[model samples]
Target chain A: AQSVTQPDIHITVSEGASLELRCNYSYGATPYLFWYVQSPGQGLQLLLKYFSGDTLVQGIKGFEAEFKRSQSSFNLRKPSVHWSDAAEYFCAVGGANAGGTSYGKLTFGQGTILTVHP
Target chain B: DTAVSQTPKYLVTQMGNDKSIKCEQNLGHDTMYWYKQDSKKFLKIMFSYNNKELIINETVPNRFSPKSPDKAHLNLHINSLELGDSAVYFCASSHPQVRGGYTFGSGTRLTVV
Candidate 1:
């Protein structure tokens, strides 16, 4: 079974400070990792995803995540934090099945609440 | 235009009453899914349909049912709603073969009073 674990339940960072949200996963094979953001009273937006190849992947809103296969981790990072960047973040893992039928069946973590201080 | 849209962004109904939430995706994706976000902000997949066929069904109650009239539409109907049913339901779509990111709708907040 595939699962995702986001250790940090909540993280507070000052404006212009660097931010990093930790994420770890357990999968049978090459895992498909994704990071999503949800603003207040809004649906989730895809921040970034890592399928294969490069470990460091860039996403929208100046967000980036690095996939470490040895560590079984895909942590999201940002050079500077902004007040508008405050939102809930989720880390999800998907199986790399042969027929691609396991695409939408993602196992998400409990989510981490990001608070950006002004 | 919205790539994925869900009707009734806010729904309030009394317990024991039945209601339905409709979803539509115009991104030409072959698979659509329904996910429930509890009050604690924990998200879990409830069901998924591929090409109007049931592909993934989680350990959800039978009171919850899903219907896909076509490849572009997937609706969820709840029977005898209860207080525990109050949560945010999100509709999302993605193309599996393409291995791209999934697009999500604004979500429907169902308040079971």
Candidate 2:
């Protein structure tokens, strides 16, 4: 079973400050990692995804994530935080072996609430 | 046009009542999924259909049923709703070629009073 763990429950950062959200996963094989953002009264939106190749993957809104296999982690980072970036972030993991199909469903973490202070 | 759209953005109903949430995707993706987000903001996969065929069915209650008339549509029907069922339900679509990235709908908030 593939599971994602987002240790940070809530993070408060001032605007223009660096931000990082830690995400750890437990998977036997190479896992498919993803970071999703959910704004107020909105559905989850894909921030970035790591399938294979290039350990570092860049996503929309100046967001990027690094996949470290040894650490079993994929942490999202941004050089400078913006007020619009304040939202709930979720880390999800999935794999071909998850549901006996390549399109295996994702298992998301509890989510980390990000608060940006201006 | 929205890639994925679910009808009845907000649904408020009494307990023991049955309701259904309709979803349609214009992206023409072969696979569609239903996810539930609880009050604690935990997102969980409930059901998934590939080209109108049942592929992945999680350990959800039997009362919750999913119907996919076609590859572009997947509707969720809940029977005898309970307080625990009050949450936002999201519909998503994706292709097998695309690994783990799913395009989600705006979500339908279901409230059971």
- Candidate 1 chain A — worst ten consecutive residues by lDDT sum? A95-104
Instruction: Give lDDT tens digits, candidate 1, residues B1-113.
Output: 99999999999999999999999999999999999999999999999898999988999999999999998999999999999999999999988642586789999999999
Per candidate, chain B TM-score? 0.97, 0.97
Model 2: per-residue lDDT, tens digit, A1-118?
A: 7789999999999999999999999987788899999999998999999999999999999999999999999999999999999999999888777355676678899999999999
Error of 2 at B71 (Å): 0.5
DockQ value of candidate 2: 0.66
lDDT, candidate 2, at B65: 96
- CAPRI class of candidate 2: medium
Instruction: Tell me which residue pairs clash in candidate 1.
Output: none
* Candidate 1, A1-118: lDDT as tens digits: 8899999999999999999999999988788899999999999999999999999999999999999999999999999999999999999988657664465688899999999999
Per-residue lDDT over B1-113 for candidate 2, one digit per residue giving the tens place of the 0 to 100 score? 88899999999999999999999999879999999999998899999999999988999999999999999999999999999999999999988644858999999999999
List TM-score (chain A only) for every prediction. Answer: 0.95, 0.95
Q: List candidate 1 stretches off by more than 4 Å.
A: A98-103
Give fnat of each prediction, in order.
0.60, 0.58
Model 2 Cα shift for residue B107 (angstroms): 0.7
**Weakest lDDT window of 10 consecutive positions for candidate 2 chain B:** B94-103
